[model samples]
Target: MASMLISLSHFCDKHGPRILLVTQAAINGSTGDELLVPTYPTDSYCESCLLHFPKSSINDIRSLKSNIGSQCFVSTQYSSIRYQLLTLIIRRSFSEETMIYDGMPLVFYDDIRGLNLVMGFKLNDENARGNERRYCIIFTIDSTDHTSSMQLLSENWNFITGGFDRMVKYICNSHKQELERQNNVNDEKSNFNLLGKTYLRGNKVKVPRNLAELTHDELLFVRLHKWNSFLLNSCMRSSSE
Candidate 1:
């Protein structure tokens, strides 16, 4: 997978194009190997393409297996139209239609700093017996959403499942960091005893009785309740191990 991702990154660098790729592999089959085969153009442009690729080009790729062997099964799949559609849906749903400027598919949501919601598709292979040519839609909720976006994607199983688990793990780590910062602030507040002290050396100060501090475990609990158990467990495992 790392090599494949690296190859994809290289491909992007050389082509100067950004695309998302999805692959379907047979049980115990190599995802990389299946993607190298030359198959029919299953590239789609929209949700309509996603529904159509299976019926159209998927079979042609599968047929190539006989002549070229499994090497012919390796193919990349991508779709700009589907990405545009999904991006538009997400942007509009999030009430960020204005973010779509200059016909760019990406839109930055100010509420989440460093977060740009992007939608794109890439080339991939469907590992079928004969000619299995298909492309999968790649929907990515990047690390910029301050963790919550990843959580939402993980909980919503309807979204494409690839890479989502890792994304959620990253979000959980970010959440932990934020929680630790808050906890540190609470600790500092609690350390200072300003109760019943109206004036101190010609300076007036006010303070609360106790500051609320949340432990990492407590934050994880909150995340578990709000997100999915599977994601929480994965996060915990990642953090601990």
Candidate 2:
């Protein structure tokens, strides 16, 4: 997944971004047709294509996978498009009107900082025989409205906004050093706190004040209570049975 993401980013470096259209796909042959399809670049400068979607323009190199987890790439465009779980497709013009996703506009806008979102399809293969594996496109439109989402997507960008490979190398080294420092501290703590053997029963426990140094009368009272409890429990059990 990392390799693919890296490959895509590098491809962008060479060939630029590949644009696609996205929309809700029809299922079960209900519509018996595609929910959406791709639009090719035309000689006529599509005022829409000549222009970016809205966040400024299309940022097409899309989503990250769970296996690869966190990813970083140079955020070359203001916004990028990700095709997720079920609905993503290449950009194209539709004969009929399409459903408008209100929040999609923000993806093309530069309103949020450090907002590089990875969007795309996910393949799941949890079923037996493995033949049931399916591809599902995922999506999130209300991210801009979400503070935590915005902040989380904001920080931890492997995306080198400034430089390219050299910048990536520097960041990687810094992270490696920081990780090593943390590991060292953890090792020190573990070594310092080590005990070759431990006897949990050796720990002392005080007797309850109420039960301490009871008189003969009190002892008799406890015995009576114990007998009463046993009898009561027995009676209850018998009744239940």
Candidate 3:
């Protein structure tokens, strides 16, 4: 039994790369909810991928729960025909234990027909802190036949889910580290001190060398002093004249 197991392992190692490994997830898992296709615009094909039948084909694009449309241009007739651009999310998966990473696998129906799919991910960091940041991944699959494309996507469902999950974990950790660095910068800025003091009527105000150190009231005080000095100089010049 041991010898048979060893032989099988060696055989798989030698030939696994040549065979398409299909997992249960790819067979059973659903990519995502199907989006509603608008009928007004006659152009059902995406200008970028040139794939047709938006409602029937593309899977799990954007967050339907949040009212976000699929990343593909075929969301609607107005959207599909007007934009005429293709966007895809390139997703990657990282293994924490192995410290190894793998990118998303491509599903091909016909190599002779040319490229059919493109995917990419985007990070929305504005107004978000660390893990709260939004990461959006888009997959645009294009094919001449809707049935073939859908079947290809279904067969590769496991890869899609695994890639999405791993990428999320990686991004969250990186984002947390970035936030820590930014906080350190703020802490350093807070420790900054002014170089000199401003004296007014025997009272002293510390004049910050860095503009970032200035408060609203301190800024007003500086402006007031400048205006007063300008007025005094003007009066002196008038007297000389």
lDDT at 46 for candidate 3? 22
TM-score of each: 0.22, 0.19, 0.30
User: Each candidate: what lDDT?
Assistant: 0.29, 0.25, 0.26
Worst 10-residue lDDT window for candidate 1 reads: 1-10
* Residues 16-101 of candidate 3: C-alpha lDDT, one tens digit per residue: 11100000100112232232233343243222112122132555221111111221111211122212222111111111132222
Each candidate's root-mean-square deviation in Å?
A: 21.4, 30.3, 27.5
**Model 2 segments more than 4 A misplaced:** 1-162, 196-241
C-alpha lDDT (0 to 100) for residue 166 of candidate 3 = 55
Off by over 4 Å in 1: 1-87, 92-162, 193-241
Best by TM-score: 3
**Ten-residue stretch with the least lDDT total in model 3:** 1-10
Ranking by lDDT: 1, 3, 2
Total clashing pairs in model 2: 27
Would you list the clashing residue pairs of candidate 3? 88-119, 88-120, 89-119, 89-120, 89-138, 90-119, 90-120
lDDT of 2 by residue, 37-103 (tens): 2353444332111212223157532221111112112211112233331112212111113413221
